[model samples]
Target: MVFEPDRLPVPAPVIMIVEPYGGSIRQQNPNLPMVFWDDAALTRGDGIFETLLIREGRICNLERHGARFKASAALLGLPEPILADWEKATHMALEAWFSHPHAGEASCTWTLSRGRASTGLASGWLVVQPISAEKIRQREQGVSVMTSSRGYTVEDYLPGIDVATGEAKGKIPKNPAPWMTVGAKTLAYAANMAALRYANANGFDDVIFTDGERVLEGATSTVVSFKGDKLRTPTPGGDILPGTTQAALFEYASAKGWRCKARELSLDHLYGADSVWLVSSVRIATRVTKLDGQKLPKPNNEKEIRALINKALG
Candidate 1:
């Protein structure tokens, strides 16, 4: 469905159902179903997923993205994802989607959904589609941003912390509601949508969430900045997804004789940085021009930073 830019109510596009659990797609394949989601994955958000760009039929950072996806599933007490011949499945999905007449030139995503099983974890599927290149272009020119106050700090439930007894005990917490899959790219994405809505209502393009006073990440991307010669991002301690683009920046920056580190970041530091940008699989790298009501100065080394990102993506 086509949505007008000035419409009051945003329209949810008709998501094409390429595959469904126990559906005809499964019967036809005879192998594993193309996509499957069990009751647990659908109802309880008990699975993990990943989205990556496909350029010229090649999935970007496939190995790294897959490793993170599997790790997140395990963290949520879900069954380990089957990796056998998964790369071939991902490529097939991308090729099919890109063949569409309206497919654009850049920015696509492959999503994997794990189905719920009666006794085990669940089944899974891979979905591939082209994303809007215009959206990426607009972000590249810089976008207005606001802060969301609805998410929790990753530190609240560190990997080793216990939630049942309200003590830092032996085991990790068991599926905390609301932010259960904060680190996982699960299908349950209401909070992220709410933050986006908040941004729209306030005449902003996007929102960055915080856990109390600590800056976590944007609803859809990783927060990155350049402070002098140092490239900094929030460490993937617990509260944020470990973005592959963010990881790539570290390697790229260091090779160019620049310092890169992951540490706890504060709002003031983000606001006061020499340059601030959001990185993700789609956008790759884009600057943040305004935060709240304040306009930030353009980075002195914008060209250098952009070069670093392009090199990394290649």
Candidate 2:
């Protein structure tokens, strides 16, 4: 017999279905961890999702997150996701989530799976829950990292630049590989999960996937470094998922007289940089204090930086 994710009844986190595969848009009860056994989301992990932060009943960067969500769904060959439906659903969850007196920072997540396991019908829903303590800890205290090879070269991605011509050749490769789902935030995250597991097993807080010496990105975050007056991150048009937080932060930095740059970063460059950070939407900004057991320089104005990022994120 197929079972649900519960033995006792639970009541929290409102769920809304906007075009439920073959079903119409509607709201579900906020009490049970309900899921039919035939959900592809669990069976094959054929889905796309986004986790967003909601503070004091307001979603942080809802527009950007929604846009990315639609983009991800498109990458997965799923139907168009109505941004208005998501926003409407989010408001419903937010209302139920903050209805409690002890409410704090809440996380709102929406998942769009290929469809039902048996029927192949599209399925999607949104849920709101409290943020984890570890995320909060990473925000309060910085994190450590270990570099691991993601088994893909940087050039394997952005193959646009003509070596001899040295001119704009365009973005997509003339001949692309089957498994090269570089930037699509698909649900097939086994590699990402494995990388983080390896890091934790080795006493590290997170893993930054690198192509030998060429830095790529973190398992669930993006890497950025600061030196002198410039803030640098891995270049776009690569295997790296374009970081929403990184983009926003760069814009914020530029407005405040900080020069932001994007390029192919080397491990040596990152190690020698004055300050390094692992940034993401949910974790926000976590300064990298140690890499491979070697302590790195901590920013003197950490408090100021944190404040600035929080303000930017907000």
Candidate 3:
């Protein structure tokens, strides 16, 4: 299930400009110029964004995304977003998106940025577009992945720790380094894009980032592995962004008698698991068919797993 770059989604997108404060949500031409040239979103990539799935006619996991959006804004010292305004803007974009001649599975993004350097205001927008057929293909056929180094260890997240004593005298602080921006979904995605390009260049569909030993996460998704009846993922509050889709999966799977755990994981954990998957809001779940060019063991209950994933997403 190798996917080519051209197989990516090409649906016409609809955009809506939103006011960070209490202002009107107006529809805008996505192809036309909207933001100013000096906006931090364009010049310095200083902003936060979240992409969510649109199933049927409504947005999926809106509250979770809203919480994350606010958290990211706080991390960047930006003003808190009004989720109601964003909701209205998303509905506007969705209305425009469904008006298209051919509409498929759709998704929307909430983009909030620090406005122009002069005014010192904030700019926000909502974009709704159809999800790619390639994503559907990957969901059904699985994906091949390669691992990349994140260049920092999880220990780095613990600030003020004495390396000599291998411990901290007080309560161990987690992700204390604000500049690292570990959990925030900011707009500075050059490195993530570069990792994806590198993976595609190397003949893989996606990339999983590791801290040389512990598995951090997928480039754009969360990594989940199942062994027996236990489902496990890497612990968040470190360098990994907590996944909304994965959280939904855990909630539903737990009720179905599946044990879910978040702990430090390694590549060996994935390799030794009965099955591995990459989960996200748009893609739902994509199984790992191959890891670093080696074929992985297939899950015995693949059909059941897919059914569970669909139910969880719903």
TM-score of each: 0.76, 0.86, 0.89
Between candidates 2 and 3, which one is better according to lDDT? 3
**Position 296, candidate 3: lDDT:** 95
Candidate 3 residue 229 C-alpha distance from true site, Å: 1.4
Best by lDDT: 3
Local lDDT at 310 for model 2: 77
**Which candidate comes out best when scored by TM-score?**
3
Estimate, for each residue in 1-314, the C-alpha lDDT of model 1 and write its tens digit.
89754343322211222232232221123233433444555666655667777665567767778777766666565556555445555555555555664444344333344544664535555545445645666556987888877554444455422321124322454654433434556666777888888898879988888876678888889999898898898866455666888887788779888899988899899888998888888767778889987898898788878888877766
Q: State model 2's lDDT.
A: 0.76
- Residue 231 displacement (Å), model 1: 0.4
Question: In candidate 2, what are the lDDT values of residues 244-282, reduced to their tens digit?
Answer: 788788888889988898888998998899889998878
Which ranking of candidates, highest TM-score first? 3, 2, 1
User: lDDT at 288 for candidate 2?
Assistant: 90
> Looking at model 3, how many pairs of residues clash?
0
Error of 1 at 142 (Å): 1.5
Give me the runs in candidate 1 sitting further than 4 Å from their true place: 1-38, 98-121, 151-157, 160-182
* TM-score of model number 2: 0.86
Off by over 4 Å in 2: 1-11, 20-33, 152-175, 178-180
